[model samples]
Target: MTETIIPGTYIDVRAEGLISAGRIATGVLGIVGTASNGPVGQPVTLALPSQARTRFGLADDPRNPTDGANPLTLVRAVELAYANGASTVVAVRVAGTGKTSASYTLRNDSGQQIAALTTRVPGSWGNAVEVSLQDSEEDCLVERENVESPFNGVRYAPVVPSPRTRVRVVRGATGQAEGFDVVYRRLQSEEQVRPTAAGRFFLDATPVEAGVPAARISVRKPGGVLVDYTGDAIVYETGVPAAGTVRIDPASGELTFAAEEVPAAGAQVTATYGVGHALPTTGQVLLTTWSGDLDFADGEAPVQGDTVEVTYLLDRDSCVQVTLTNAGTVERFVGPDADFLSARINAASQLVSAEPDDLLGNQRPVNDEGLMGSGSNVHGADGANAGRDEYAAGLAALENQLVNIVVLAGQHATTHGDVLAAHLALTANSEHERIGVIGAAGSSVEDINAHGMADGRVVVVAPGIRYPDGITLASGHTAAAVAGLVASVSPQTSLTNKPLNIPDVDQDFNRGQQAQLIGGNVLTIVRKGGFRVLRGVTSEGEGMPYSAIPTRRIVDYARYGVRSAADPYIGRLNNVRVRDALKSSLDGFLTRMVDEEALTGYELDVFADRSQEIRGEVSVVMTLQPTFSIEFVLVTMFLR
Candidate 1:
């Protein structure tokens, strides 16, 4: 496969509320929720509600889905936040420690596993993934000309038969042969043609090998040739067939001619002819890939047309392809077969990872489901598994993010108030200054008041909100809605009568109940014409400074702006010149804030002592007078 451009995790800056050029993002919300899929303990930024399903995956249990279940918590919470009015969200997905990944095994023809595919991250959503493999082969042909056969020397053919008969003849008297008036006798002997062990049919050029026996053979051909009787004018048997013809007996060493072709009666004749025998054919080798031969025991093995054809299965290369499907989204990966398939899938597949079994001989994975691969749906993911530790890990992951508001989805803030409170305090001390929106969802007003959360950084709301379907959710979900509302508007804007965009609440408070909830420092929402926040207040008790939501946010915003203004002068000289320039920058930013009405008035002082200047410290202190929304209006009337 070619190189793939992996999609990035961060959302587009244009879609988000962040401005990298020294401006703060005041509308970003950070949330933690349990999910069925996605990298746990990592923060992922996204703007649209649809992006949540694509990045974190859909429900774990597709057959039975729930808004409160872990499989649906993250997605539902993000959708709710967006529905309220959040433009950007930094969401972190978390699961329990004992989470598992969905996996499948692939095997070869021998029933041994060749490779395996697994989910990229641990969760039950990966169970939807499936796999398939295909075969790739080529043809192979073998010739049988020189192949060694098992029956090489045992099978042969005979050129000459046994018990052959031949007649002998006498030579002339003038020939100095041993027998001038030789006795005429018929000779009989066996001249067999045997094959060698290596399937050779011919014998060596020896005296007795070619049927020329070394016996009492006095009238043999001189030098094994008959050349016109070798100057013996009266030669008969020694003459070539051009002058006279003769036949030789294989055993008796005698020569005879046809009656019409015999020499003259008084001429000298010589018995110079010899008999020869032909060899037999034998079986030979065929091939290494295929080895067999024709039955040559009954007759001579044919030597003219002894070719054989062989065909066999050839071990060839293969290609393996894998597919990962989840929530209607599909990703396909391809690579060479066997163990090499794992590398390509791991590098390119965003939905699932892969592993190969090198010890199983790297056999090509078969296409059969039962023989090669399987899909499992045994991973666990439930919202209850995420304890406080998991949420803490999620919070840690979002610590570096530039978020304005934080919220917990589908969970009660009262259950984990200590952890959330500690996190917000730490973040505020570190200058991040993000406020958390929490709610005692599903609790009575008395229970909410009973729970003590006096931290000014946290905005606690009471009595969960209800949906259009008549289902009332917990306060934590309402907290998510409130967070979205907070992020949509400016920090200085009051949330006293802002529309929460909700259908209704679980219980609308009466005047006394509202007074009790407000007195207990809970940001209570009531239904008038539509759902709107009754009064915005922190958990901080009555008459406490910084108890208003907007007041806290405004200070945080100004602190961020002031820091942004002064951060550029850190490395410069710590003398009066640099201090004056830094003060001027702060004045310019605070004046804009005053003009925007976030502040009523302010004071500025930038100074450093001789010892402080040596240590490169430039301290700037500001007296900020924040603007507050009017809550009461009493008219003075006189008798006219």
Candidate 2:
């Protein structure tokens, strides 16, 4: 049995039958509007409601119709988006002309400029921002200093101590207040008073013309932050080995030093880099160059020209004390720039803050040779240039982005050109899978119908929504509200028969108003306790594919399902096995949708004809029966 034949030796194999795909969330909302704060024309993803309040500064209150801070439309819309179950939102703040951030520069005891701080964005909100820096109490003990390794030429310490302790480097002397603090995982004992005596790591070391360079080395810190030797990733700290003495070769990732200013024998040489955002408020500070090297004994020394790594950590020893002076009074806000740093001194308080950035300027100093580009903060001006063009640009920013619903909060679709731009964006070559919701402020049924936006991609609401605060905003303001209601429904669920019973909706449509809204294809708040969609028709006439919201949604879902399912089989062969696998996957997806009640039934055919099969084209044909929502019911009652 062992020498001749093994009849029973076999391996069990499993054949894949069907591959199911998880449903993608087509519920990400995109809103474009003006704000009192935040980066202008930049897309910021909002995960929580508080981020909108904090970053965008949407906390201002307007007294009447013509308040200067009238961007509250975007604010309320963002609030509704979260309240109505929207999880992720992309908010773009479009700034007008001449918008500039407020800025202030600080000077040290010797009249030397220390740090320049500016607001995060261009707006009037920056005018109230105030910033101050002081020494942090957070500090670490210099656990074991070494000057042996060539990586750290002067006085270098390891990235992390063997005993595991905290270490922070203050910009000035220890315990000195009013000085910008610098925190690091490792400590530098003393600065190299003489550059000629200190060994320099050549950033532009000559390549050996073959294999990887022998002079190649990596500078790193704790938490896996590797100093980028290739690009302009490393910024030298102020003072020490002056600029131009060290050079970086982006192509080969090399760091060479001038021949005369090489590190002393057994000296550890290293550099430092910063990382974080540059935000200015009341209590904030920035970090400069920070690095650490190693020292080894006789046998511990490695081969010359070999790679070496330096590591360190940065920690806050104490808080910065900031005194903000707006108008006349001086208010003090103390602690780190993080909102959660202290419950008493949070971001909501009158005092503002400036967040730290390690990699400021990325070696692009404003004044000197060793200054960082990101270190200085400059408040920009918010001119009157912010308008429809800016709004259109903001909408353009959402092109090809994964967004399902779009809310043009402040722009009235009846008159504003921004609304037209938004509609055109949906049908652009980008083919964004989204629906736009816009409100028409104070416009009558005749006016809305005259605009003639027959596309089902956008919906216009009329009769402006009224709030309980004795203020009735324009009809266009309700777009965010409608979007929230639509978002509350599941992607698999249809909104054809859905009723929007949102609180704080003071205005309701009467019988005549409802008829007018239906005739004009406008959405309105029904008077019967909650709001009900009177008709499912889009801008197009009845019986069209996009007529019913459910019809459009299910079609989108089907398209999404098929595209997501078939993307994997693109490069595969068009043989029988591949065709069968694709058919099974597609069939399995449709079967699940049917089982979930999203579809009544669906027929999916992969490689339906021989002609398509020969051209290496996988022809997919799907005949779908959408799950219709019941808007009308008729019953005959027999007196029994």
Candidate 3:
């Protein structure tokens, strides 16, 4: 497939071949919940925990309590996710009722409407944003002066022009009061420097770009044709006795040659190189910020002619300078205008404007007088339909994206059926293999069983764990630790025996809690060592297949590998050649799994039915035999 840039003045281009086959990224996770601040409904991928704090402001607000079952719970869960071992996280902030963004309006000198500037997204976080402008320092105007005669006895004075020109600062002289080399242009005529047998000449100006030469050489050979060297093919060779070529460093503008490379005794060599004359560095000037008639002077302050006025804005990054020369005596408005600041921000921002793109010109309006507003509460939808309907839409947005695990910040009182529905939707109904870690609020094992959540795809845990921090994180928080523990090892690694990263709880489970754990619900209890998972069981009950986390993990790995291996052959023909190729690819992938001891064996059945092939259907049925994790050990010791 070919890639095309969207219709715009500027576009970023990337090659298609760089897109590789999709492999299940074990450490990548998807989290959905309400946040104090962040883009609502948008899936923002964050690489570092610091980025999460910056993008979705920290939840440590004194205004709100740190109770785990509230909006702030999402923040703690994300922090825990990163703390454990998630390398990349795709956090989607779900916004409910009464949330808005803060904004301001900007106007021009005539009191005419310019544009409006708003926060990157909806949240109270935008209230902290402040906008201001500062003028560029060291800006001045320099006029070129025409001298009466040659300052020195240089023959090619006007032919190459004087090496330097004196100019007067016209405006914007608000900088240090010292001489500066502002503009350095190529010399008018090449300086006639005496060349050594071998030496180097540093040209005044660095070439505008690479691979393009800006200097030329003319040699008048005694009793021979005058030779000229210019452009890329131009070369300077050493005298016939010791022949070698002189070279120019394009970037530094330095010319080098060996001593023996000097011209023969009888030859006269003249070099023509580019030069630059700069304005004062301290009291600098902008060439475009002037109006009326212009004149160049030597050491004279040339007077400005009768004209209204002029102003300019320079974008140092893009080198785009905008100058407005007044038409009449109308008042002029300058400083970081709306459009200038808008272009600067929009150039690197993903935030969208509240107004239509067409109505807002290249620049968005900034209203200094406008009040920051538009934040609201999203909890109005709570306790209505179990919050499942709200989070369902959120999960729908992440359909095509690859997310190995999905966790819902079950801070609010969500119905058991709704939690079960979210789990089934994430794993069973979805085309991708995803495991869901959900929270069961009560201590009764029957509470979990009654929810009908006994599916291999879901892991239900009970009553929250108290973190070392003062806040008591919800049961859903355990999923972060669980996901981290699972993602810490490779797909081939046995997960059953692997101990969890210390959860740091203070007490062991009571008799009733131990009874609940044995019945299949995952729980965290303080053992002799530290806080460890009592069981790795999924929501799956006694009689079902794939009851433990390891079994489910093995199936996920096998399915993920099979799909990844078969992705490359998607559009090939259904004939024996393509089928055999498919089988070979699967065989190789399965062989690695067997070698890693993740699987005992695997069988692959490629598309072979003629009737199915007529409909252009390519199918592959992979039967996997997985190596189960050792969860129980039976031994008897006899005393003689």
Best by lDDT: 1
**lDDT (C-alpha, whole model) for all candidates:** 0.62, 0.54, 0.52
lDDT of 1 at 600: 96
TM-scores for the candidates: 0.66, 0.59, 0.57
Ranking by TM-score: 1, 2, 3
lDDT of 2 by residue, 537-613 (tens): 55544655676666666666777777777877777667778888888888988887899787999877777467766
Q: How well does model 3 score by local distance difference test? A: 0.52
Model 3 over residues 179-272: C-alpha lDDT tens digits? 2222333332354544544544554455522222445656566877676556653443222222344455545655554465555567666656
Cα displacement (angstroms), candidate 3, residue 616, comes to 5.1
The clash tally of candidate 1 reads 8
Candidate 1, which ten residues in sequence have the lowest lDDT sum?
A: 178-187
How well is each residue in 1-640 modelled by candidate 1, as lDDT tens digits? 3344786554422211221126678989998987877888888999898899888776334224432334346666777788889999999987776567766777777777777676778766665565556543332111122313332321111111112211111122322212011111111222222333542222121112112222111222324442342222322232243434344433433344445544333233332222332332232221111111223323432233232222222223324455556567666554345555676677677776667886863556777432112334244333336878988888888777898898877666668777788889889888788988877744566887765788888888767767666566667778888888999988888888788876678887889988888888888888877888888888877788878988999999998998888777767667786688788788888888889899999999999999999998978899999988887688899988
* Clash total of candidate 2: 64
Q: What local lDDT does model 2 show for residue 395? A: 80
